[model samples]
Target: MCVDSPLPHLDRPFDYQVPAEAAAAAQPGTRVKVRFSGQLIDGFVLERAAGSDHEGKLSFLDKVVSPEPVLTPRVARLAREVADRYAGTLSDVLRLAIPPRHARAEAAPPAEPPPPFTAAVDGLAWHRYVAGAALLRALADGRAPRAVWTALPGEDWPARLAAAAATSLAAGRGALIVVADARDLDRLDAALLRVLGGPGHHVALSAAAGPSERYKRFLAVARGSARIVIGTRAAAFAPVADLGLVAIWDDGDDLHSDQRAPYPHARQVLLARAELEHCAAIVGGFGRTAEAQQLIETGWAIEVGATREELRRSMPRVVTVGEQERARDNAQAAAARLPTLAWRAARDALNAGAPVLIQVPRRGYLPAVACADCFTPARCAVCSGPLALPAAHGVPSCRWCGRPAADHACPQCGRRRLRAAVVGARRTAEELARAFPDTPVRTSGRDGILTSVPGEATLVVSTPGAEPLADGGFGAVLLLDAWAFLTRADLRGTEEALRRWFAAAALARPGAPVVVVADGGLVAVQALLRFDPAWLAARELAERRELGFPPAVRIAALTGPPAAVAELLSLAELPPGAEVLGPVPAAEEGHERMLVRTTRSAGKALALALKTAAGARSVRKAADPVKIQVDPLDLL
Candidate 1:
């Protein structure tokens, strides 16, 4: 027998009895097994009730999978809110929020002790770091806290994480540090290992760490064996004891999403964790996301950074190169296609015995392939691979599943011999090498090419992973494909382009010529030309406001099977002023997605309606799966 709460109509929690053998170690947060409909199912223990509503009839817990109670009161409470925010379910949120159990890997030996990190954090480092302290305090207080948002220049950002780790360890507390990429984590881990060396102080938590390593680290955090934790998006729910701070670096990056079931984003999990744990949070990035700016405006966070001039001294000089002008002037076209001035500046800098850095907007050999004539996507019939003319192989290979096949004629247009429509790091590298043939052209992107190019006579082609230049400086930097960015249709396309531009520019030597390819007339271009992220953010912020998007309102998306999504949309009981945008058709699977937008005042209610609908018994009985994404970056 299973204990169903009387409020079965609502998506709320119900308690189940613990089996006699498991009761000894059974805790509120532990995972438990229960018999429901004559089948064993997994369930979490919200609490251990003294008695039940049943007249002395109670189903004992089947078993306690682990002694560790993964869910905290903070996590449970926040899970409910998250479910509501994205029109998701507590079960779904839980599934996304908590990492899976690894019995085999859980028993592995702990990693070797890290080297001592005792460098004095002073001056530039100290100032940049102190701002993150607010987050450190919230975590120590033991409340799931809201995520934080802060904007800083690239030059001043590296040491900020070190300061966070120092602050946490200094307080005799533990923490988990997560970044958007492997390189960022490596930098943070190295910096932390140098600043606070101890086996239990800090650990890099990534899927690449292997199951045993991850499990050992996970168990350590759950057991409160480590105080400081560091990893990627998946590490958001890391069970650090006395969880004090949850800091998200560059929340704007798409890499923050889990890309798996429950499909949670780091920012969401951090905020949920903060709210549940009452921990202070800090979301810091070189550029501000409207979402973060919204948090600041709502009095949830404080803004911290240097004055424009102070930042400019540390910031690189940016200039825009017009493609139209280049096309008009054959003289300019002779230099390069990505951006002539930027490319030449990089070459000249390299010739002067300094490394040059380049940033491409999108990744892969062409993530999106379209009909050359009609501009409609040319997908492979066998596997939906975007057809491309590979410089290495004539046959195009599906980027996703890697099925190689001949380019089929565009069924719609009967056009064959598709051309490379999009520019990527590989293409960029090939072009740069041809331009600076004599100079060594090192590249990094999806190829695992590290960005640590020697800062002498080298042209480094990278797609964002190239950071803090291996030597702490690059003589010149190129912000290529500026128009390639302006042409993108995504909401954050411009914002992300600017962020990448700023990040790449930050690698340049002060006063070095940084060239952007977009026309200087464009807003994003002018913003870079002016070296003003604040101004750009303000403009983006205003646009978001006028559009009734997040910062002004909360938005949630439901995508998956069309019928299921439509069903969820139909059942939505939105509060007044909380409007439903669409059961609109999505790009794939004829999938339908319903977007719920709510004003600030009605945000919680809208969230609640979604929660109710998702957890409703009627909807659950329908037995359909719809992916719920809150603050979704990919609307298509």
Candidate 2:
């Protein structure tokens, strides 16, 4: 049985004698109670054995916790594989795969079977792709092909994916789809319900659902009552029977990465599942990441994207407004918060009876503050933390330590007055309110995000993803404070900025104008104008390959107290050609981090080496704990 204990030394399964009362219930996949180290713990029955391998007498199972199988045999094996891939314990992966059992949920009636799949319900969006129809055909035939699809903005990708799932179901196979967040989940769920003509055949698993509902849906999949499962990151491990397809939407999103131990990314997990289960895989998104591109280059997945002519015909018209263009008009207008080009676009859009979308990089009021006289950034007097204005017409306070800086003096200018250096969504809304007093100004962000805006001549100021969709689409879009995004210290800064720009621009009606307030010479800006995310993604992958970065290689991050971390590293038997970075200081006091890089082909060897070291440390009862994260996204 796979025990509940997470101890690395005891990661393997153990043989257990089933008592007379529990033998009938202790089937493979069922939960049972077993004694380990003088304590009773819950575990899943992996398999039935004829005899024990250990020479010592095996202890009898205390009792059977549940007669129902919580995990399918395929899922149990897949969990073990995922654990090895992430250099994590089997118990940890099981914790992620299996939710806490609820007796009430188990007693619920099985979900109704879905209506027979009909080809008439095929998604219309597939017609726009170059090979979308063929891919759907392959899925229906259970061909187990893999593809990396770049979905067009404003396209009904959920419908397309749901149609694919329908095709799989028609073939008497199951499908599992994972998306980025609740919003995506809701959209996909609605689309699936429509495509399937009902909801009883599929389970919508979401963390936002209460424990009872979540467990009920999970059991539906585990019990083979649902042929399709849709959810967020955690859904990647759903125990769908006879899995024929696995799809992940918006793979670039951070939410797709699990935050718990092992920290397996959704895309990678789904890819692994496709291999293990011999199923088809689809990694579809509006923007492509370097990892996805690598899959195409490595011949592991095929590429599916729109042709250049189709892209130009479907995408919005994009224009870049640089400082030089803004300065040619008037010096005073150039120094204004809104550039001359943006001002004209907003004015024109408003005049044309269409809403204008203004995307700011940050949220809140006066997110960044500086001295009025010398323009030096304001900081707290006590702790020297960066100061910000949380509310309009309010005193500035430390963003880090919460100390007020009402009477603060700049070190450079010794000025008491503070000025706004970086404007936020709320501040932008206030300014737009004053600029066009008669027009309605709606703000969208963390405070109260609007899902959709009414079709009207208004200003919708939002922060990135929080931008509300305009009915019939907006007439114009303005991407403000572009430098804030393009100049980030992240390796994917340009790629991410272009993604945000494309997302906001896509909200505009076809042929509508999109003005980006940044230098036009940037390759990212060019990619945005051409509506070619694939080009930018290819460029990013090329650069990473040249630099020996991720997708082209594997990286492992180890973090802990310096001495403990060093000891762990010393004990690790790194793969051949593995290179060590540094024991750099971490954000936490007395803690340090280090990175190890190896070729992609050697990733498994490196993971095994690290797992061996961790297991050895656990057996020795090491005092210090070191966190090992493979293929880490956030190096900083």
Candidate 3:
């Protein structure tokens, strides 16, 4: 049986004897209870045998948890492959694959399908792309074709995905669609229902819904009742029967990265699933990541996107406010965070009876506070924690401990006065409100995001990912605090920054002005102006290749206490050409981090080596635990 044990040493399955009374229910794919270490544990029955292969007496089954075979042969095989690929335990992968079975959900009556969207697929954005038709043909004919799609700004990508899914469903095969987040899922789910004609045709799986709802959807997919599945990262493992296609939208988004053990990304997981299941794969997004580019470069996937002429016509007009222009008006720079050009554009947009979007990088009233006198960061007088304002004009308080800083004074400057080191969404909204007192200003961010802004003239101040769509799209978009995104310590900072900017700008109506306050000469900013994520991605990949960084080379990060991490690395039997960098101090006290780099061909071997080393440590009962992350999004 495949035991539900997360131990590295117990990765493989063990044989167990089925009692005569429970022999009928102990079939393969059924969840069972087994006696391990004198304690009952859960396990999935792989197969039943007439004869024992062991020389010694086998332990009898503790109990049969369920007669339903939730773990299908395909899912079981896929889970095993995923575990091996990530060097993770089977149990962890299975935990992702199969949620806890809810009996009430299993017994629930089948839901009738919703009305199908009978709209024709002609004139869809995907039809404008070169390889789009070919991809659809492959899915329709049950031919496995892989492609990387770059969606144009304001494109109805969900409709395109639904059209592709319809093609698969027309055939005798099923399709699985994985998006980055719940927002995308909601959009795609509604679109898919419209195209495919109902809830009976496809099931939407996401943790955003209640447990019962999620379980019911999962049950439908597992029981082969629903041939199409759409969901967030977790849906990548959906057990749809006769899978024909696996498509992931916005693969560059961090939400696609799994937060659980082994931390498998939705893109990578879908890629592996396609290869293993012999199905078509599509990685579609507005901005291409280095990893997706690598797939195209390696001929693993074909590129599908609009032509340059089409891209130019589809994108909004972009204007850049460079440092030179800002320097030309020092008073404007000192007196206002928004450049004069951006202010003019927003004013013009509002006057034109259209809403304007202001994209900020941070949220809250005062994200960062500093001393007014010496320009040093303000800290809590008692706890020494960083101080911040919880609300507009509110008293300063320590962000860490929530202690009020009413009587606090700056240590370095010895001043009681404080300044806004970093302006946030609320602060930006406050300033914009004051600047345009007659115009209505709305705020959107972590506190509560707006799905759609009220129509007509208003200024919508939002952080990245919180920009709401206007009725007819925003008349203008102002990308503020460009330096904040550009100055992030992560390796993908530039790529991420461009993505955030592009997403907000994409909301603006075509021909409407989009003003960016950043370095115009920078490649990322230039790409935004040109509306070319492919160009930026290609450039980023070239630089990474030259530096021997990730996407060019596979890298894993190991973090733990200095001594334990060092010891683990020392014991690792890495693949040839492996390079180890740093035992640098980590953000957490007493912890350190290191990176192991290797060629793409050697990534599996490297992962296996680390897994084996970790298993050895586990067997030895090591006190310090090391965390290993492969292809981590944040490499700070």
Index of the highest-TM-score prediction: 2
Clashes of 1: 28
Instruction: In candidate 2, list every pair of residues with a backbone clash.
Output: none
| Model 3 ranges off by over 4 Å | 109-124, 323-336, 381-384
- Counting clashing residue pairs in each candidate, in order, gives 28, 0, 4
RMSD of each: 4.4, 1.8, 2.3
Over 1-636, each residue of candidate 2 has an lDDT whose tens digit, in order, gives: 999876777889899998877778999999988888899898889998889889999899888888998888888888888888889988899899888889988887777665656545565578688878788889878899899998776676788899989888888899999998887788899998888887677888888997889998898888777989999988899999899999998788888889998898989989999999999999998888888888998899999888878777778888888855664454434433677777888888889999999999999898899988889988888887789998887988888889887778889977688889888998888878877878999999889888788878999999988878788889889999899988898877888888788779878888888999888889899988888888899999999989988878899999999887777778899999999998788888789999999998899888888888888888889898889999888776
Q: Against the unseen true structure, what C-alpha lDDT does each candidate score?
A: 0.67, 0.86, 0.85
Error of 3 at 34 (Å): 0.5
In candidate 1 the C-alpha lDDT for residue 428 amounts to 71
TM-scores, in order shown?
0.86, 0.96, 0.96
Better of 1 and 2 by lDDT: 2
Model 3: how far is 498 from its true place, Å? Answer: 0.9
1 versus 3: better lDDT goes to: 3
Which regions of candidate 2 deviate over 4 angstroms?
A: 323-336
